[model samples]
Target: MAGDYVRLAAYTGIRRGHLLRLTHHDVKDGFLRLDRTSKTRTLQLVPLHPKVLSVAQRLPLGISDDGVRASWKTAREACGLEHVRWHDLRHTCASWLVQAGVSLHTVSEVLGHSSLAMTRRYAHLAPEHLADAINKLT
Candidate 1:
């Protein structure tokens, strides 16, 4: 299940509490519908990559998403990572998307954030993402 834990962190970027509460129904055909415990009372539906889809398709009914998350810390450390909290995966995913030039609105929606206000925190990453704003003067 250590591998599943890695997928859980890599896929939905969900925190331990919400991941634990995940039921079989949460893993649908194309999306992972996360009812996040955080503020904003929003339901997040992130598109599942093909790899994630394959994993979700094989999850036994009523499997605990949280147990996987909890197990990940030890495994991650064993894999030679340090101070790598679960939340760090979320940041990593978001940062990678931002660096890839995905729009902020898209990132906000994917993260299930209520507004771009929170997503904007990563806005300054990767100078290329901001080149459009800076290039207007030319």
Candidate 2:
């Protein structure tokens, strides 16, 4: 269950609180409708990654915050990844999207970030895109 939660979070970039609040009804039309988010408290529709489509189907993840914390702690200790926080999974998603050449604007939308500035932190991950744009000027 915790593994599924991690996968869903990593794939969709949804916050832990928002993910916990999700229900089966939230999954529809190839998107996960987040009625409210912790940071912005606004509605967002995050597209479901094909890899996590099966995992998203089992919504209302059924794990309490404490349960997730415990599992994360155990997993981190076992794997010597104690420095990694659960929120890092969200960062991982953003980094992957940026590295894959997805535009910051699109990634910002996908992450439901209130501003594009919030997504800029991942821009450095795709320096090649910047270079490509510079090359186009030639």
Candidate 3:
């Protein structure tokens, strides 16, 4: 579970289940390949951070998503993150991307979000980003 947290924090980004299900073969040129894209009508390839790749090297080539989800859920609860959901880790990823000044479109790609509208939930947390954007429009 420590491994899962480290992997989740360092990886391509959430959909932890998606990451858990990823096989070594999924890492490709410039992106972490997804077998399916649910929210987005089209397929996506998330650019992987080197840390994610490093973590991947430690796991078995193909780990089951269900096991990862169950283990992560249980472990987080034990660690007193009683309310944490796997999806919230995804949200944290999005929020971090927003705060770090990554463009909305790029964050959308990182999180496999279908649109910037969906990415807007974290916009308020970017500290001066919205203000900067508003200034541009003025």
Pairs of residues clashing in candidate 3:
none
Write the residue-wise lDDT of candidate 1 on 42-135 in tens digits.
Answer: 6778787776676665544344656665576667778897678778877777887788888888878877777789899988886774566878
TM-score of every prediction relative to native: 0.75, 0.93, 0.76
lDDT, model 3: 0.67
How far does residue 27 in candidate 3 sit from its true spot (Å)? 0.4
For model 1 the local lDDT of residue 68 reads 60
Tens-place lDDT digits, model 2, residues 43-107: 78999989988878888778898998899899999999999999999999999999898999999
lDDT: worst 10-residue window of model 3:
54-63
Question: lDDT: which candidate is best?
Answer: 2
Candidate 3 local lDDT, 1-138, one digit each (tens): 446544654455656656666665766674666766455556677776766665554444344656666677678878999787667767877777777888778888788776679987887877687677789994
Model 1 bad stretches (over 4 Å)? 36-41, 60-70, 136-138
- Tell me which of candidates 2 and 3 scores higher on lDDT: 2
Instruction: Write down the lDDT that model 1 would get.
Output: 0.70
The TM-score ranking, best first, is 2, 3, 1
